[model samples]
Target: MTTTTRGTMHPRFDEILTPEAIAFVAKLDSAFAGRRAELLQTRRDRARRISAGENLDFRSDTRHIRADASWSVAAPGPGLRDRRCELISPATRSMGVHALTSGAQVWIADLEDATAPSWENVISAQVNLYDAVRGRLDETREDGSTITAEDSPTTIVVRPRGMHLCEKHISIDSRPISASLLDFGLYFFHNAQALIDGGRGPYFYLPKIESHEEARLWNDIFVMAQEELGIRRGTIRATVLVETITAAFEMDEILYELREHAAGLNAGRWDYIFSYIRTFAHRGDEFVLPDRDHITMTTPFMRAYTQLLVSTCHQRGAYAIGGPAAANPTRQDDEHRHRALALVRAEKEREAAEGFDGSWVAHPAVVQTCQEAYATVLGDNTCQRDFRHGPITAQDLVSLEGVPQTITLGGVRTNVSVALRYLASWVEGTGAVAIENLMEDAATVEISRAQLWQWLHHGSQLAEGPTVTRALLDRVIEEEMAVLTRNAPPERARHFEQARDVLTQTALGDYLPGFFTPYAYVRYLIDRPLRMDGPLSPDDLRQSEQVATPVTNGSAA
Candidate 1:
């Protein structure tokens, strides 16, 4: 067997800097180093907003709007069929640091079902993830466009092990375990703070949020961290995963509680559906939806869940992110790709119709489909003249009537005034400006530079227009494909094969303390095909025998 040495240690930020970059670093240092008063004030303001039931309008605060709803942007419509696929890596050790850095919108560096458990592997995985994000220096390809220090896509998010034990969840016995939990969280928190301190604040996606109280717990910890470690507030927001039935009901309150440091809510479909079944399994007569995969967003429970989430978020003024379709990536054949594209197009169209501003895309290949979906719905610039600047009403949006943009189109001076201001923002960000249907003031052309600044530094909203074109779509595809195919490219494919092999041979059996399963460690009880009687406790393992190789083959059946 070949033994590979761990690569050289990651370079710290301070070690690689030119004089100007160093000076810029110094300024950023001052920004976080000496701002207790400002941090406190911001936190208090955010707390007040949460208290007032006003979730933040992230568009007005943060500089970027998430494409969380981008997944289903074109569903149930012309461009696609009603299909969504989960983007699974099919790899137990699915850490695609290179592929993720190359261009995909989000990378679920999974430590859950996609990974196996071993303390060294777990720590190595976490450390690997940290180093990948912390910045790695590699030579640019000869033909590859020179990526400046700034322009790489922000596309990695971790789905760490949940409370469940299927993956990397730590457990000494058959019971719930806190082992490695604190170490993992602390490491993540420290690096996350370092990232924020380096100016990319609050960019984490926390998964498995089952209740409002859990969200509160996270918030409390965040506040304590800010006070104790001196990380700035409003600079470390997280997107809470709404994956459980309890979390669905507590959505509003969860958003309210975590308002200050919350980026938005994420709809985690698979685990969510799984949890739903587990939670309500006892209610024989209860109207539980069919099994997880069979339940679409159109399913009554799912529809209500999604709509409620959208309504709650919009009502509280937070972004309503759609859930992942958990869609499959494109097949190797052209027919498969075409069919998948059609499905993607349809799904995205429906998501748009359902009022989601953005969604998730699992693969680099799928990003074009998602972007195109958003473009088809959001690209129409005709509504600019219709914007009504009057006190915006919920009813207008509900009926897609009397919306500020629509009401303002009647040539009301107030509407036009607000539209003009909005248009100014659009123009400043990009060279062109169009809101709803009006061509921006041609005279505002000079403000494009300033608008660019606003869009990059402050979250500015834009009404869709021609900017989302086929050319741009083709460009992103070409660029992303280059990244995906570079440097012995099918790297992820290798890992996928490894996982498939593992699953194919893995057997089903119980490693219970007193059970007769092979490979069961006497000290550690393990089981699969979970029994309804509940897991065996630590006491059960006291007299157990230690065994290994529980399953002779991957298929337990």
Candidate 2:
């Protein structure tokens, strides 16, 4: 097929609009069409109620709402996220119940990219994971003491096979299953509904999204599923994987289009990188240019792409989350583990600095790093102050005609004021509040308040508001105080002292020639050639203590 670029929609996609694609588009169109009139009426009614100063649940107030029933606690600081990075892994029949529930915020039991052959395996993995997470069965660890599978603290999110893996077209182990792609999504949606319903959190991650049309299609099916299953609307949310390059351009439109059903957008990096390669397959020299690690995201194109995603989500008031890099993280030693941890830590820090609220983690090890990075960067007290300004007027918070403009940092923005409230909660750790606004979700507001309170009671700072005095920013002065007071974590305390010394020295205006500063080190590393001769060795694997346990190929552990 000849490639043509016409307007915004790529022309190559025109010819490949097969029957499946057409059906997909029709499904989305039908969903919006069916709900359009009702949605408008609901919005009108909601506007009138808000105009009259009535408290409302934003989920119910919308024409359509998406997300599972599980509720999330909002954090301090506008746009601050709980560094609980999601841990996604494909559960195989061989993965013991214990392995599946190991430390992580959310364990995505995947059926799309992880599993190979067997519908039986799919069903088995699902039931096993559900049971494991529910603590119905117990499994022993290497220590001989039984690790009762009680309270698998990690949330279980499932991603059923996509059209690319439909049982009808591609047999699993050469046998056909009773379910198709649509049927599988619906089946799990129904089965998981009872156990996970109601403000707990969603358990679904929609994968391999290629276009806005695809998102629309899923929204339609989701609406139907809710109606048929008697599941409350807005009880289920989807994390759409924006893997294709095109989806990036149409992101804001897609999120706005499915605001009722979307939990947020996920940057599907692996598939996206693969898609990038496929799209420019002709560039063979660059194709073998380097493996993922060798390629620094600071590169011109990558920087633009990453920054674009950050800005786009911020502009629209929705959460702009970074995608997973899928680095192999099975190192067990502190130093090596720190290196792996450092890689992930660096990524999260970069994203946070770039203005992303949070990011995706492929392993359990990176969660602390993500959390710590956010804690260090945003600090406490970001959320305690009053941001609602003036009376909570309709014009200030909500827009009767359209959506609220997102909070902007420089040129970046977010989709809703709730995101701003979330950041506030992250910072102050307690007592931040959001005035009822048309675009603000009541749950979001409540969660933000709760999280802020939790943080203040437990955060690094005092219960009072943050005092960012000139004295506080001076590390040397603080270190001296800490040493005088003999604070805990002596090693860490010493490190701070050393950093303070460096800061003090730098302030002295003594320019030593030929010094390789930290900035220079970073630029040198960024400019260095990517080392992709082979995969990590055993020594490398044992370094990161918190990654998925010992590395294994596709084979069993």
Candidate 3:
């Protein structure tokens, strides 16, 4: 536990880096790494008070804990109330046995932005999520088929890696620890008592939250990791994506700062439209935004941010979910799989008629079209949290009124060819990349390099003419890197030249960096050195099997 710096450990990643999971990730980096560095310097002093123009309300010191009304939250745990969820990739052991047999009640797995944090994908995605939470996951098929999970029932959650990322190949006294407390302290110290004795427990999602004092520092690191793993104290539920525009103006104070480890709230729609273009990129042209394919989720500011996140998770009972139906299903084009299953069944029937209690599908051929569009609006309902639509104010969750500010030249050359082919499949380790058919990830390359730094800091014009300069986004990134070097393949030309130097240092920098995986994880996933047992080529086993299948339309060469 006190081992100050042991960076390269791969051979059986010491069976989930044991020494009591590196002393429960060094006691959650010595009890909350200085309140996670003062909530990341209060997120760089609220982005320099929104670049000095200031204006991001909600928090007259938590407004009597959001006007207290006999608080709620701790409920739906164990195989979390159904709707449908799927987003696999615990660095692929046959895509975590095909996303725990992809029927989809829940299967997140993730390890942040559908993975590629590479320290051998952060210790082989913690040994394939500790063999898929002890059902003893299995895999094989390159055609020789195998895959297991022995009678899978789904529900696994996980996600970890957001408190502005760290795990720089694990260190201690020398610093660098919190990759969200080393992926939720090694999956709640190897699956919290085998997922609460196998009836499902240790669930989570969290990801990029902005405030509610970073969900009260993850509810004081889940009440000091369930009182140092003696378990039973709201076992550990968590959901919280709410994906930033300052956590959509503090969703009920982030469910009243994780009310006993809350379990709901998602709609992390492409990192909440890349945190509303990196928190209004230098305040100009009324928060400029247009093409991330015309900002869908039926845009009037994404239907007032998914109807104020399903009326603040059904007025605080919780479970809202829905975002990410990143269309990936062109199985040999039956008219592009019925127009990507009728655009993911009209975005899962507008998140199952705006009371979302489940949604998210990045292919297992659209998880039964998002479980029959949430079973035709939740038939034997496991959610609608008693249908509360809202008294929704705060200017309907910061209304970027009537939002279709059309800036096009084919949406700035499809945001410089999908942020240079999803940062060349995230510097070749591949953190989700279907591409032209969607499923891009790292929140669609942080909304394609924060919409090319808010269209070159608001000079934005392009509906077929000009403007948008940083010398016209460096001449449309050298004409999309010469059409990705004449259609890729030469072992993916050094990950499209390290994704054109990480999309020209985070889309032509001069401010607005915030993240492109913490400077492309210390430059291209940890500057060289520790290879352990490297050898994966054949284009790193075909970008780790097209990051668990579904890459048809324009195969993202």
Candidate 4:
């Protein structure tokens, strides 16, 4: 296929969408687009097999890879040893500045779930990240003064959209390109050498990988990218999130696949839970999960997952990073703030004590607590890779037999409310929202909706005696919408309606869609004519209206 560098570009996108950057992205798309499509189809087939009652076990073919004791992942790259990482959306300039100055060791300049994926947002995030990489990020304060990063800034690790999402606005050969490549290619094209010059290479956090084959794909992309940019063989490093049930079973293989480029693996708790639910949604009451609130890391199943992660990473000589602490302190209430702090402290302490090298925090407030917890366990040590805690069996990993399984009316209502609010915010171009004090993102929303689907599908009996049927869910949705409509501003109320439609379709549909973004993207995020063809023809977007308008003050008008 001939490489075409022409596509619809947002007005604000011109700065980041340079001719050279466009060509580079086109090159990546031309090279890897076929593999990406095949992987996506493989995902569909795997999901079908699981739905047909096929048990998810470690692949027999890969037994040797898992059993081999001689293999280990590459050593941690620069600035990744002590990973007290904080996730921040790069779309927000002030947030980007705050993340750099917040003193966390690593800042996840997120372009995936934490972002709204608006064309404006997509370009703006790239611009912000570009500025951030060059140490040119500055935010004007209320006093008309500027705030900038200190002498020592946090290391930036970009998390592009997963393999499943597409950048519909950007096309190659009239087909939409992978969102992952668009993000990775553009960032690498512009910032790879600059990041290397600054002593840190182009680092990434690969999200939602279901198997080692996916890891191999990423590794291959890294190799091709490095070669294209004339970078050293191992200059690029990635930390894979073992967030899927299938991935949980293939940790060792995943690391082996990316050994040359792998820094470590993350225990992505929420998405892990969502994956479990989605994988077993067809299975009867046995796999029916309890409330999302009760599914803490200390729970038996969760404990098993994290323990296996720590053990697997250590055995493979990779850093074992723990999940995100999503608590955002509520300043209006002292007790609430204290409670939130206590919760974060306990969670971090648990991760540290359980032999994780480091953990993630969603807000800056928890950074110190995470650092202090790691300090207690690590002291001067970079990681606990020497700590071996498992010869854990497949039975142990999937043993949900005796875990807590109570469902409450409150839990159902919470799921509905949270999912509605989140979808509403998401469609309005806000991927992260503070819901009841917690910084909720796509993962949390996934759990909420997945749980709702599981409960309704299984006719789960709530503690209050009502079964979680579609009728019960509809009543609850109506009740929640009424309350939101009554109290919310008019613009927000409109968003609430949009959110309701999205949540209802995704949660109550006969079959769960692989992801909510694709459906919502076409409906809410794309303003142009829906062209289902090759590279978006110039004529396709010639008179296309902007799909995503700017949100003022994060409001959804």
Tens digits of per-residue lDDT for model 3, 1-557: 24454567767888888888888788767666766666676788889888778877776877886688788788888788674565555456777787788778887888888787877887888888888888888887789878788768988888888887776666665456778788888878888898889898998889888888778778877877888878878889898888887887789888877878798888877788888788878886877887877777777766777787787777779988887777777644788878888878877877888788787787777788778877788877878887766565666665778777788877777777887788787778878878767676777777888887888877888778777888878887888789788956786877888788877877787777777776676667763762223322223211111212222211110
The pairs that clash in candidate 3 are none
Q: What is residue 298's positional error in candidate 1, in angstroms?
A: 0.7
Give me the candidate number with maximum TM-score. 4
TM-score ranking from best candidate downward:
4, 1, 2, 3
Please report the candidate that would top lDDT against the real structure: 4
lDDT of 4 by residue, 205-311 (tens): 99999988888888888988899888999889999988998999999889998999999889988899999899888887988999987887887778888898999
- Per-candidate TM equals 0.50, 0.50, 0.33, 0.93
How well is each residue in 1-557 modelled by candidate 1, as lDDT tens digits?
A: 11111222233422332233323322222222212223323433544453344432223221222323321111111111111222323111222533344344445455543333333344555555555456542235478843332333444445554321222122223222221233235344446665654445434456656555455555655565565456665544556677665566666667766777665566655555554433433232222232122446665555666666666555544555565433344434787667776787788778766766556654546656776776687574211112112222222211212112211111122222322333223212221223332223212211221122222222222233222232433343334334433563354434323222211111111111111111122211222222113343534322111112221111110
Q: Give me the runs in candidate 2 sitting further than 4 Å from their true place.
A: 1-83, 92-103, 142-144, 168-190, 196-201, 282-294, 325-329, 332-334, 380-557
Better of 1 and 2 by TM-score: 1
Models ranked on lDDT: 4, 3, 2, 1
Off by over 4 Å in 3: 1-12, 17-72, 75-110, 117-119, 124-186, 189-203, 206-234, 240-261, 271-289, 293-299, 317-401, 430-441, 446-462, 465-478, 482-493, 497-557
Question: After TM-score superposition, what is the CA distance of residue 1 in candidate 1 from its true location, in Å?
Answer: 41
Predictions: Cα RMSD each: 21.8, 22.3, 22.4, 6.8
